[model samples]
Target: MIRRTRHVPQIASSEITPETVWLNRRNLIKAAAAGTMATTLPTLASQTPDLKPLSYVPGECDGCAAEEALTPLEDATSYNNFYEFGTDKSDPAEYAHNMTIDPWSVEVSGLVNKPGKLNLEDVLSGFDLEERVYRFRCVEAWSMVVPWIGFPLADLLQRFEPTADARYVAFKTLYRPKEMRGTRSFTSVIDWPYREGLRLDEAMHPLTLMAVGLYGKTLPNQNGAPLRLVVPWKYGFKSIKSIVSIELTDQQPKTSWQELAAQEYGFFSNVNPEVDHPRWSQRYERRLPSSLFKPNRVPTQLFNGYADQVASLYTGMDLKKYY
Candidate 1:
């Protein structure tokens, strides 16, 4: 079950380690031993065998246009970890194709001058979709390079004309039990209609994209088809998929992951290795395309390596506490 912390204490930046500053490409390679991982992992991992000894040698994180030789389309689309369809990584790709999206519409409400519902077509009527290659880092210690196509989220919020009172933006995912029959997980700890949010400034950041497509083609159902938020700096969960409702509010909204396990999944789920998870270290992550010999292991970056663009946003707040 999802656990919560009794209290969230605020700490000083002085106490916080600069885990994101270093480059540990060599350290990870040093620990790359051929061995089998015999452990019952989180529900987010693919439902494949639990004890597979990995073997392979991985290349370093290197590429152009903020992307690293985009994770092959096959792996990107097939090896997904979307729990809405099932706990298996391949569940989304196999099951989500049946999900509906053409008749979709997103409801905009709260702290907006013109709050109302707009069909998907109306939302994309005039906005321009740009292709941006971004590094996608999951909280599960894994990473991928993706070429996402979408426009700045600020463009959509501006259309509704956010009021001065709008301080945070909250988003919700679609919920259709009947359509996703295979995902009716009774043992699941998460609540339905996964929720996520961002500070007003973060939402307005040009780097924050509302993706509608990937790899030069339309979005696949498993990948949050129709629309999804892609915040590269933060962990993957912050980028809520298949958005159904978007609302602007004055107070920070309670997000799904944080609500599920307050201590494990903090509100500011930043890619900070210094602040370790209760169960594991966030200091390292595995870059995909793994085999028996090369289960890639590398040092994780602060803001997922985009600290140059987003580090300033949390000027005064304690990331450890907020997290």
Candidate 2:
């Protein structure tokens, strides 16, 4: 059952950069240095021939606050934690272009009535996309307010008809060493094909989205082109990127981060400021596009400020214990 609570907060118009400003900024940067700007500009969607402008109803989904400023497209795309490309924040924007995403297909299998490979086109054709302004909080104590374009995960999972035995839903990222350089990097400690999972109910939550685009355009390769998951209430890592496989399993799937360091990353990594990371405090976050002169720091919220909508999901569990 999809929740009909439509009173979620909306982002203030003053905080959003006008579309014209974004275009003009890109143009100015390009005119200054064609070669340098080619890789730095936020207009990455324009470079991909197959990537098209997405049609989505604006501000339909929820979990944004009126005071939050939407992060600039450049900062959101350039600074990322896509370890499949490299461990560095700038690595994704520099190396993700090498990944091939046009003929993408996701394999749906395990404990489902219908199991098969569905092409990206087929998936998009089935649903009406909506633009959702969501607060993306990272475990590293940084955050961003992003306008994501996608449909609810519940709608897609329902089509597969998950069997009663399915207790959790597991997702996997694409792994091609030839293209993803980080897979072969000696400094990497993660097991290949980064995996993430959610309990069945959490996966079915109306707030859980399967995103294909952002900022009214198809996703840039650096930002998980073609497909990704967006669970706004949880830390950003819960939203897996470049997803290629989805499985309905009876047990909690071992996630990549948990495998790398179970003490630091838990399966139910809900945003709880009280439960600090082993090495850093989760109580505060530096919103992106921040500088040393102006830190733009803000107090972190429980469930990333979606507690009113998601607290029920963790009513009986101990967050600190699970986290």
Candidates' lDDT values, in order?
0.77, 0.86
Question: How well is each residue in 25-139 modelled by candidate 1, as lDDT tens digits?
Answer: 2332332332211321221222111112212112122221474667876577777767889878878866776567779999999999999997977755557767778888889
Q: After superposition, which runs of candidate 1 have C-alpha atoms over 4 Å from their true positions? A: 1-64
Writing each residue's lDDT as its tens digit, candidate 2 over 1-323 gives: 88687797789997886554465565556545666455564444223334578898865444532247789877788888898888888788777877899799999999899998889998778788888889999999999999888988898888899999999999999999999999999978888999999999999988898999988888878788889999998999999999999999999999999999999999999999999999999999998878999999999999999998899998989999999
TM-score of each: 0.79, 0.86
Clashing pairs in 2: none
Candidate number achieving the greatest lDDT relative to the actual structure: 2
User: Candidate 1, after superposition: displacement of residue 49 in Å?
Assistant: 30
